[model samples]
Target: MKHEFHWSQYLDTNHQKFLSDFKEFLSIPSISTLPEHKEDIRRAAHWLSNKLSTCGLENVEILETDGHPVVYADWVHANNAPTVLLYGHYDVQPVDPIDTWDTPPFEPALKNGYIYARGANDMKGNVLLLIHACESYLETTGKLPVNVKFLIEGEEELMSPSLPKWLEENRGRLTCDFIANADAGQTDKRFPTIVTAVKGALGVTIDVITGPSDLHSGLAGGIVHNALHIMSELISSFHDKDTKISITGFYDDVLEPTKEERELCAQVPFNHDENIKRMFGVRDLIHEDNYTPAEVTWFRPNLAVHGLWGGFQGSGFKTIIPCEAHAKLSIRLVANQDPSDIFDKLERHIHEHIPTGVKVTVSEFGVGAKAYTLSESHPALRAADEALKSEMKAAPVHVRMGAAIPILATFKAILGVDVVTMGFGNGGNIHAPNEHQNLAMCYLGARTYARFFELLGTDGPVDH
Candidate 1:
């Protein structure tokens, strides 16, 4: 099971071309959150399918999902070798606050050795690395060392609403020994890391309507209750003075962090003051006693209000009481917590707090993902650690992520396999304005993934 190979040297010479191709891939405005970009999402899927076919992957096709389509491809010729599924998403986050960006979010720009784009850091750059790594192996050796399958989706940013059923229906087509996820990032730009745990998510929209239509404040100021006032009260009711969730049973299923897990979360390198100033652009942050910012972010559950709207805005004052108020609320869940249960309790609590003369409605936005953890002793993780050491000359760091990736737990439940979420992108500016990732990191990631493919295929402990 051998062929001529020099992936690292090839990367050394062809990195500029790789960056150019990646820029082309990132140019598509495949914002899944916006319905207007459906064509763009389809274009991105076709583009990826073409790239995979060019790489000589068999069965390359665009499989339809209820929402945006999924791109699937594979090479399964390796006899008795471990099969690996490479997962990523082509759709990107909506570029809201577009005025804050120095350049257009969809337009790729190279500056300071980093590529500025919407999906550059959060995912698309890493996706390109996976594709090119597999392509490199096939191009150089004319065959892959293992059976590889790609299951890139188009709706991860939307909590992957259509993927669970798709996975269940196509389980036989996508069976694999383990999954390699390119969505998570490294501890920092300098060291490799593997994400062992991730927080789950529950999203809901709160709507309040107190009147039939907007009424003049002069006529309704004292007679009618303002919907915005009621909405503010409802939002405030979600938290107590101590800032913990006030809903009953919200914390019932939460698993408190163990001492060893807390220690691992602390091992991630971050300067508190610098991160506060540079990464978050805030003067200070709040946390309970005995927990660092990283611990609070990666280990604890928290609620946030993402969007609030219900009034008039036309560069001047409109003397009318808005009849309706709305807010977008989300909660991050820790291990053992169920998003459905939390939503049920939250909805009940909101109804309990509704004041007289006002009607409230709460509805979940997405299906929600569950929190998950992988043991350090997993052979797939050990193989990834060795790959990082071999390529970057440094041991990998194990850390938990604060983001919600619903598919991780689904993969474990459905396929009975754990995903190795090794990091490669820059940590700063994900899901924010001026999002960017280091091109050098992408190159290193390509080399590391190439080596990882070989490790998973030959003399690797993943088969056990």
Candidate 2:
């Protein structure tokens, strides 16, 4: 079977136009986490619908969900070729601390070969890449080799709360042999990487109330319990000195990593501890005992306290005992661990750990997902490997991801399909100010997608 193709040169010829189009796509601040960008989200969905239609896809339409919209498009003409469902998102993380940016977050700025924008790296650039790749194939040869369908969504940054119901209602329309989860990218351009697994997730807010209102610190200092103090104790109960989650039954459902999985994890080129410490601005690294950060990253689960607040004031101390305290908590689970089960365990733990005077409530806020692992022999992965090898001139490495992706799990469980997530992202500074994408990687990803479509179609892998 032929792996390399010259048609990717189309991306080179139209690089300038691609850049302009990508900039226009990035200009819309479709921040899903905020309510004010509702219209912007709709605008992004419409823009994608038009772009998908012009890319030679048929029956393109804007799909509505309870929260945000999902853009659907497809071209399913290849009779024997496999139908590959492509996945991406138009929603982006909110650009906070807006002053630190060298350029406006919504304004695409090309500097030093990188495009600085809010959604440029996190995924709008990726969405544009495959669309143009499809365009290249259709405009050059008039048809695609394999059937293609797009499920670009607008609430990925919000953890896709409404995606479950939407997927359930539209399951028939989304039928396909495999999925191309374009939500992730390779860490290095030198050697492409394939993510084999991603941790599952559960998010909940902890609300602790000690009384109806605040009390004077002088009056309640020793006589009454402080809400922040009680909250701190509750949080402290969740972890031990070993930096392991101390919640009961937390590890009961965790799937132990196989020997081969551990060996492969060790071989990956990564400095887990040093890199993590640097990224988090911590002097030291701490994780589960008898395991390095790399081993624990993909193999073990993690419970983290993301936010905590009880009492505060302008400049000086408030000198009052705050009656209420709140905390945002997120837990990442490995394969075989269910988020709902974990939430039940967390609630039980909280009930057992709380003090007498404190009233605690655990409200599940974000979308929860089960852990996902795609088999290495899956045809979608094989096609991605072939495409990457053709473009990078080297074989790709497979690694497991620590982050949570709700769509991968949802599609796998509900639709009974596997997803291969491939990309050309360098993978840093996303979800923060000054997020950027390498312009070269952007076009390279487009070319890679072009090659992937050809390889999948011609080889007839994952055929129905």
Candidate 3:
């Protein structure tokens, strides 16, 4: 039986309505980190709930948490049909330095074939695309091909503090045959793609206190130990001369990519020169030997010094050794690496290198482990490939992300199923000023998701 939802036909008919509704959503300024915007976040969650209910989803409600609400909806009628848990975030990063944007971030200007807004790509736009897909299915066929559920959260940007607990408490309600996360980037400006693996992360802050108070460098330069210099030495110890991460046992649990995985990654087009030119850099990327840029980003562990601060930054130098200095460091871990074990090892490494004269303290932030990956031969990958081929007239590429999505790992542990991460959007100053998402991809994503439902319904459960 050929189950077809002619989504394009309805999309053509309702393009204007879609754009208008999306603009309204983008205007909400649902920044999760700010306390003043708490009501705005709730308003966004309710808006999503209303949209889901209007699309004929049953049991729609805003599930409240300690921080923000989670909008959940489902339509699970078909006993044999596969259930898909679609995941996305309604929260967006705070728009600081608002002066840098040409148009107001909340206003959502459409220009140059893209939509420019705070959450355009990072990821309210993608969330709306999924909703639009469900609407099209309901309008065209009066029913969906498979069971669908949406788990949209309002605190994804604020470290997702509430999600893990929410999932643990509502495990029975969130169960599904598979999950689809629409929060990643595409292969390029052209081809659609699926992310098979995402890296884990651990963040730690190191502080060095040298003296009781800031002392004049000219008066006590030789007497006091400089906290800034001590902190710098500790930071330098984490990297070798070749720029490889030197933290002990960092790679002990890393699972190497198979020979076939390497071949597939190599086949993906990567012009190193083009990347360098885009970044305005004069040198190539530094990494361990025998690995491509894609491999370094997806298959390897990395340590990065995210921030450093000490003292004296006015118009001129304050001649002081400073009382204290501090730095924030983050590590991106690959598959099989435990975040707690990594954090312990890193703290030990820092302690070994601490200068004798300076007192040091270490603090650990949120720790998240890497997610398990399905093989390239998995049925979900095949269905995604077929869907992209049919909808976009192109073969989809398989890739991995260097960042961690703790929710993905949570779903794996609690629900006992691997997820399919297929979405559209390109990485371009995403967390920085002037963030944008391609209009074509936004529209194409909705069409692709509609096609995915049709394909999944026909193909049945994805064989491991």
Candidate 4:
């Protein structure tokens, strides 16, 4: 506690400079999905590596991935202490629909106690906080209570394609007892939160072809099957009248929420109709009759068709039967479900339902991760609760999020460790335009992470 309080003093002395440095970090426009921003992504990685080295962490380096580079650093002087892997991402989602932003997405601006910029809250903000927390400890006491390592990757928005191989290759170097992910968000601005579970993701592409080329509808209407129609029919087959997934074996591995989990889920606040209007701008949500809206999103899997393309649209009617059609699907998986098995079942179902005149192909992409859940009694979570309560003066809430953090599962499968997903960012507007983070939460987060490092390193839980 003495060293932690000393670390807080370091944070206090450098508070303004930390804010200024973070704004500069947010201005790089490290959009991973865009090819033109490759340099920007590399710049962000270099910037992070430099900060880690300057922060007095040992072995700070930028390691190359097939795509973007990963920034690695650590302090392992605390022999026999638990090693905590701090995980985060520097890459941000593309700022599409550019006109929607109030300010330039890459130009960080401070207004009304918030920083408005791309990657400001989604992850980069927390990344900075974690780094500063480490810096605080090293600057004050010249060491940490626990061994700490940072694995800040640049391809998280792209589902972290290079991480699995990287993790396997560097398992010994990156070994840790548990991970602390700063990529999560709080339940509300007034209350901190710890994510107990995260749904996994599987991405697939569907392609259909009815002929070699397009043909005039007048000539092809009765003779040939339309690829668009075939694709539409195929998409329809994925769901039934009750909106449940129609694919066989889709729910075979799903773990039913325990009674305790159900109770915790029930305590999470909700206003179904208000959520539909505020978050989705929709009149209704589709689901089975037996479950609450929260259960449907958090405890169950849901599939969505992100894009559908086939015919022409050039402000004029082009009467042609398109020869090709395609759709991109993203499926969310809950605990105990395997992405590979679901993809295999889906591919088989698509092949079985192909029309007579059309051919269909299904391709699975990326090394997907399985869903994960941590026990309520996990020590890291208990440490997180204590840290959050100390920082916010309020107990944190526990919830399972619908979104997937692929690396959480990777840390578990490869390192045999659970991840404590403690959050300081807000939930809304992460990937959207005008994305921002509350500066006040940033301060609280720095204090908590600093305290958490101490708690994890101690022989037993540190008294609050």
Candidate 5:
């Protein structure tokens, strides 16, 4: 119970600088989804590279991919201890509906024990915590407890479109025992959560052309096929009344969850059905027949129409049959589901349903990834478990996220190491407006990171 946290002194001395740097880091609108923010993305990468250098990390380089850059840094002086590839993203999701935010999304605001900013939780804060945790050890003890290599990329918000090829191209330099992904988080402030399982994702867009141009509904309503209706029908065909994906072979590769695994999912603190209702302000939660809320979230696949657009805007009453319609869809996959296979099946289904007068086209909407689950006994997972228990005063909850990290599969398949996620984040508005991070939780995350390194190497969860 009486351990000297050597990092505590460094943390106390540099508290003000930490806040100042965090705000500056969050201020860059590195919205990866927007072309206009490319410069900001590069700015974020450079800023992070410099910050890593300042943290005593060696060989800091802004490694360029075909898309955005990946900032790499390392401190490999732990002498045969385990090496952890710490993964993070410098990019934040685009703050859509910007008018809904109380303050500007990029301008970080510290109020009510939270830091309100675009990347506050979904991960600029997570990246900074890793740097500070490493710095605390380097500054106080002149070395990290374990070797660490940072792989902070600039395109996670786009589901890491460039990471697969980029990771394969640089696998030799990134050889490690495991990955420490700062892209995930705890279920609540009361306890820590280890994301042992994460769902895969496949994104696609539907484009329908039913006519040459817009025509009056009175003239074209019966004669012409409506593009909007065509697009809607195309998406609607992916599901039946139960909302289960009805695509051919959609469930073919899905790995079923074990009885024990489902039980553990049921034990998690965050209730999926309840939170879905509360978070989205929806009155009813949809179900997939023979599954609990937790089971559906952790084990099953889902299809969702995330974005849709067609004719008729200003002040309504524009009675016209639009010539074109478009929609964006997101499909979440569980174990053993291949993104490519799912993508192929989805494309085939769309074409099969195309009406005689209409032409339908579909393209990959964004990035794709296969589902991933870490081994229960991975050393890095154990270290994270111990460190979280030491900090949170409770055993960490093991949970599966229905969302995709997109790059986790690439890490395992290409780099041959399972990524052990040790992020301090959550599901509350990660890609929505008014995004915020609990400053206290961020500090706790930093402390836990230091201890995890200690447990992974020569230190005893603290310094003398």
Candidate 6:
């Protein structure tokens, strides 16, 4: 099979150009969830289409979906070579509460060796790293080692609603041997890591209505069923004193963490006290008898109340009893757990705890996705391990993310391919304010991707 020649020289020569291109890409505010920025999202897709075309990818086009357009590009160089599909999102989350930002979110300021922007860490940085890797091969050798495809979507933040439909419609063109997603976070700043598995998520909204309208608390508080109390009671049942989720049958499908996996988790350097203090401003860790905080996050199921709304909250305390209360709850599911089954059990559990005279309504906002794990023995995994070890000068660790990436399941189900989730960027204030990506990781990530492709090109399995 043909492979790219002199790829490293090209990367070294065009390093400055690559950084400039990334800055320009980050300048576009492709926030997909907001309707006002629809054109901006399309503009980002067009920009990526042009970049892919410049990198020598064939069949490049912006295919419009129900929501945002998907940029599809591929090169069918050799029929015998393995086809790798690359997936990432150009769209970013809405930079709300914009006043809190020290520097403008969309301005793309480089301060303290870090890029300060809304999508800097969450995705755009990683996207550019992958693009540069492809560019390196093309600039040096004129062709790729393997047939490659790029599927950069614009609706990942909004639950990726259009992705499934788009994938179904264009199933024929998306056939590939394996997928690689450069959209996840690294294990830490000191060590290079590959996230082989991602946990799933399920969201539900529960509402309780007790009376027709607000009533006088002094008179009705004693006799009437309180909607707030009922909602609280139902929410409280989803957890125990150990903080482990209590939804019936929630763990029935959960695949226990293997001994090797647990050992891998133990290898990750963690300071629970510092982590808690840095994250939640807490003094000590909480919950569970046998498990540590890291284990709870990576190996177990968790239920969290995302949002709760009910009574008044203006200036002073209101004496009136509210007629209704609502709460938005979400569950993070682990490996082997079925999201649909978990949602059903949660609904049933809520109904069993409903208080009389208060009508409880349960609406599932979204269902969770199952976690994913790649075989450690796979050749691609080994290649990834070698690439990271060479680049970082330390053996990379294998880790699992607590967060869910729904596309993992979609890729596995639709294309029948396991993805190599390797990227740089640590989880620090990811979705929250002050989100930032490490500047050093940016270079390391690019090097890793370049080396990964080089390794795969030279020694990757030829059977597939």
Instruction: Give the Cα lDDT of each candidate.
Output: 0.85, 0.86, 0.80, 0.85, 0.85, 0.78
Candidate no. 6 TM-score:
0.91
CA displacement after TM-score superposition, residue 137 of candidate 5 (Å): 0.7
Per-residue lDDT of model 5, residues 350-438, tens digit only: 88999887888889966678899887776567778889999888888777888888889888889887888778874356888988888
TM-score for each candidate, following the candidate numbering: 0.96, 0.95, 0.92, 0.92, 0.95, 0.91
Expressed as tens digits, the lDDT of each residue in 201-257 for candidate 1 is: 999999999978999999889788888888888899988876777889887877778
Error of 4 at 435 (Å): 2.0
Off by over 4 Å in 1: 1-5, 271-277, 460-464
Question: Best by lDDT, which number?
Answer: 2
lDDT of 3: 0.80
Q: Which is better, 2 or 3, measured by lDDT?
A: 2
For candidate 4, report its TM-score. 0.92
Candidate 5 wrongly placed segments (more than 4 Å) = 1-5, 272-282, 459-464
Off by over 4 Å in 6: 1-5, 13-15, 78-80, 271-282, 315-317, 462-464
Q: Candidate 2, which ten residues in sequence have the lowest lDDT sum? A: 1-10
Judged by lDDT relative to the true structure, which candidate is superior, 3 or 5? 5
Off by more than 4 A, model 3: 1-5, 97-99, 271-283, 314-317, 461-464
Please write out the lDDT profile of model 2 over residues 370-463, one tens digit for every residue.
8888888887777888888988777889988888887799998789898888877653578888898888888878988999999888888593
* Count of residue pairs whose backbone atoms collide, per candidate: 0, 0, 0, 0, 1, 2
- Which candidate order results from sorting by lDDT in descending order? 2, 1, 4, 5, 3, 6
What's every prediction's RMSD, in angstroms? 2.0, 2.9, 3.0, 3.0, 3.4, 3.0
